[model samples]
Target: MESFGIVKAKKNNKIFVEFTRESACGESCESCSAKCAESEKELFEFPNTLSADVGDVVKIKTRDRSILSYKFIVYGIPLILFMFTITLSYYLMSKMFMKNIELMSLIMGIISLFISYLIIKGIDHKFQKTNKGDIFLEKM
Candidate 1:
């Protein structure tokens, strides 16, 4: 079975889709990892597809008991933490030393942001090799 969804938001280049429980997947299913311990109301973000914009409807095919895509987890968490730590470290160090904290924080934040972008882009490239959805987008 599959799920039909509508793109609700786009942030940092990722497309978020809102899928209802009444779709083919049903309101109660043991197939979804997110649903196994939570409610059926779900939002999925495809970090790769850029062809569709916000408000576009999408279709996603799911196999019973399959895991939600791990592209985000494997890549996103690390990138975010890296950026945050870098920025925070800069801020803290400058504050403790009574240096130009704001400027240092700003500069480090910008650099960390770029690093995060590169990390995410690399992960997207890696996902493209193994996942078809990472490379294509369509409107339903």
Candidate 2:
């Protein structure tokens, strides 16, 4: 994905860029009917490869491959984990002659989802601290 932002700050070899909704809106807003440009601003850090200064507009790029991995982490892993846990719990409960095996499996699945959520949140926190990611920036 490609986006445009204005450099918000500079520190060492890193530059923080701020992207507003209007700047990210690609096409002419007047002709569009979709409720596309929500009011928000996103800040991202990138290597200072372009030697951009504060208040300068820059172009940011993110590879499609990296995006796919992010999608899997945010959506796929929890779903897969839930399914696996539910199936495993159901089989185990059945073998143990437990009553309400379906209910037990559902409860186990929900528990697994909660665990996955914590894991994902930790990963997100670590990434936020490091500020090291796949974004590439250049002067516009």
Candidate 3:
């Protein structure tokens, strides 16, 4: 993905850029019917490949592949885990216990979902340490 922003600060090979939603909003405000609120500009630091100085307008690029993986991790995994756990727990509880199936399934599903959250948290911690989703400065 690509975005344009103004450089806000510079440190070594990294620069902070402030991006406004207007850059990505192509339609005229008056013509749009969607309820849109003006949002505050967001700032992000990216690896400075263009040697851009503070106040320079720069273009930033992030890999689409990286974004897909990130979205899957953030939304997909938890959903899959939750559904899988619910089904598996319900089936296992029905067969193994043969009594209080409903109560046991509900309990086990919740417990498994909590365990999935812990696993996701561990994955997030590892990714944070590696700076895995960093964007790159493409132009100035």
Off by over 4 Å in 1: 4-59, 63-79, 95-98, 133-140
Give the C-alpha lDDT of model 3: 0.78
Clashing pairs in 2: none
lDDT of each: 0.68, 0.85, 0.78
Q: By the TM-score metric, which is better: model 2 or model 3?
A: 2
Q: Which stretches of candidate 3 lie over 4 Å from their true place?
A: 11-13, 22-40, 47-50, 98-114, 124-134
The superposed Cα distance between candidate 2 and the true structure at residue 4, in angstroms, equals: 0.4
Which candidate gets the maximum lDDT versus the true structure? 2
Which digits, one per residue and each the tens of the lDDT, describe model 2 over residues 1-140?
Answer: 88789999999999888997563465557666774754579898877888889999998778888788778888988999999999999999999999999999999999999999998899779866774567666698
Q: Candidate 2, which ten residues in sequence have the lowest lDDT sum?
A: 21-30
Candidate 1, number of clashes: 1
Question: Could you tell me the lDDT of residue 19 within candidate 2?
Answer: 90
TM-score, predicted candidate 3 vs. hidden true structure: 0.66
For lDDT, candidate 2 versus 3, the one ahead is 2
- lDDT of model 2 at residue 82? 99
Q: TM-score, each model?
A: 0.39, 0.69, 0.66
Residue 116, candidate 3: C-alpha displacement in angstroms: 3.8
